[model samples]
Target: MRMNFGHLRGVHVRVFVPSSPYFPAYAQGQGPPPMVQERFQSVISQLFQYRIIRCGGAVDDDMANIIVAQLLYLDAVDPNKDIVMYVNSPGGSVTAGMAIFDTMRHIRPDVSTVCVGLAASMGAFLLSAGTKGKRYSLPNSRIMIHQPLGGAQGGQTDIDIQANEMLHHKANLNGYLSYHTGQSLEKINQDTDRDFFMSAKEAKEYGLIDGVIMNPLKALQPLAAAAEGKDQGSV
Candidate 1:
């Protein structure tokens, strides 16, 4: 659940962590969409249980810098303990994502990601940034990919020029995804031409994630009924 903070005067856009049990301010983040607030929140809860620190959302710096700082701090505090990152982001600048992604790849800590809602654009790239033993969303959750699009205001010639830039951008994005996913560069380029969104099941099949995690709370009632049936059979 979220509210319109637009009414506030002279407001500075800051990412906020929603209070636990009811993540209200979560969807109102700086780096990504707020829809998967619940899923990201769940990952945070899980990480805290293991004593990993949470960080980020520092004003105009794209937030990745803040995230990196936090991870480094955690490593210093406890060199032996592994860290988990719960990322729910639509992605920001390429430079920012690359920095954060590199931090995850090179950091000595154990970094795992749970793509709760949607990891679109550079956000999906960050998911691919996880070191190893990564997890993903339930089958219904979305994962998307594509090149960054710049806003344009120009004529046909300018449009053609932008198209060329788009092609180059696609090449760069494919280079990274192909290197990580091991898919053909041609396939990655083709897929990013248009927005490609995959369900968790599809992501697993493509080797994007280790597996899909069904919402256990949503399945509780059915499991309870199955348990009751077994008990009645014994009776």
Candidate 2:
């Protein structure tokens, strides 16, 4: 069935159920039934209505493109509303990560990032790049930062060229970390020379995140109350 998620920029979310006679039955516990699949899609649609975006797995071109599109579309829908991005990535492709980081800053709506698992390398950079005073992490989440990794394989001249490009990108990334985390460029360089890992509390201390979310329930109360007030005021 085609479900029109009108609130999510009119995207049509399709839930395809296998009609083949060979399809396993739910009674045999082989897979979820069609109704369950539809419910899963509905849950995702509800999350979009609240402007929640998930950046999970690796930071790559496809992931970055989808996130940037969502951010821009949501901002167009309501610039005043905040966009909450949940990040749980191992980090990949500095160029792709930069695209996402830049779009987060370029959009009109504030982007609040929450780290739920591991935010390493470029993932850490993006988490730290969230709107000031809005970056957060769960108590057990981990964040890591390090110098960009380069894989240059070619003739000597080509390798040299790639090395130079990598160095340039490294400098740019360090500068951004310094700016966002209020750390000196020298400090950032020193720390990132080796893999630097931080728990949520340590990340907050290092200025990578504004706060560690200790109590999920209490943490959501303020947001829920604010939303409630807005709804009543609108009526």
Candidate 3:
């Protein structure tokens, strides 16, 4: 069976499924429960919507794939539309975070990140990477940024290589921070040398976010203004 679902930025979503051999059994209420099947279908339908992407737990490769897929989908369907990314995470695999961070930068859509709870470490990196003047944090959200960490196993040579790699990652992250937040590499290094945490307002003051949003709709007003400004500039 094929199902046509909701649209995101005018992009139609379609899902396809093959007929089950036990269709008669299901019709007779002998296969899976109707409620369970409906719930499964509902979850699948939600995947097609691209207005928002949630990062609620640790940011891993699975989450990275979802984030990237949504961004690419949106870019393909409507490159100029704005997409919201909601982040509430304690941070996770640096590589996974980098995948998301890099994809966000590469995509054509303007990603507006909203930090709803905690945006720590790599999560903070992503929050800060949102399009300039579009990064936001709810009034009560917490934001944090810290140095990258690594663990090594096996021979001494392997440990040495891991140590060097960790240093390289640290440099990369610091450079990212500097570029996104308009901070210097020296300042980012000093701030991230330890676990640094801040309130939403403080993060805004520190340039980690453009503002602390009491109401997200109000925050979006700038996007319209920005668009107008761009049009005026190009004319």
Which candidate number would show the highest lDDT if scored against the true structure?
2
- Please identify which of the two predictions, 2 or 3, would achieve the higher lDDT against the true structure: 2
Q: Give the TM-scores of the predictions, in the order they appear.
A: 0.62, 0.79, 0.74
Model 1: pairs clashing at backbone N, Cα or C within 3 Å? 27-34
lDDT (0 to 1) per candidate: 0.57, 0.75, 0.72
lDDT of 2 by residue, 1-235 (tens): 1111011123666544323211223435556778886786687667778888878766777777888888999999999888888888778778888889989989998888888888888889899998887788888898989888767778999888888888888899999999998999999999989888899888988989877766566344323222333221110
The per-residue C-alpha lDDT of model 2 at residue 97 equals 86
Q: Give me the overall lDDT of model 2.
A: 0.75
How well does candidate 2 match the true structure in TM-score terms?
0.79
Report how far off residue 230 is in candidate 3 (Å).
Answer: 17
Sorting all predicted structures by TM-score, with the top scorer first, yields 2, 3, 1
On a 0 to 100 scale, what is the lDDT of residue 3 in model 2? 12
Identify the runs in model 2 with alpha carbons over 4 angstroms from their true place.
1-34, 218-235
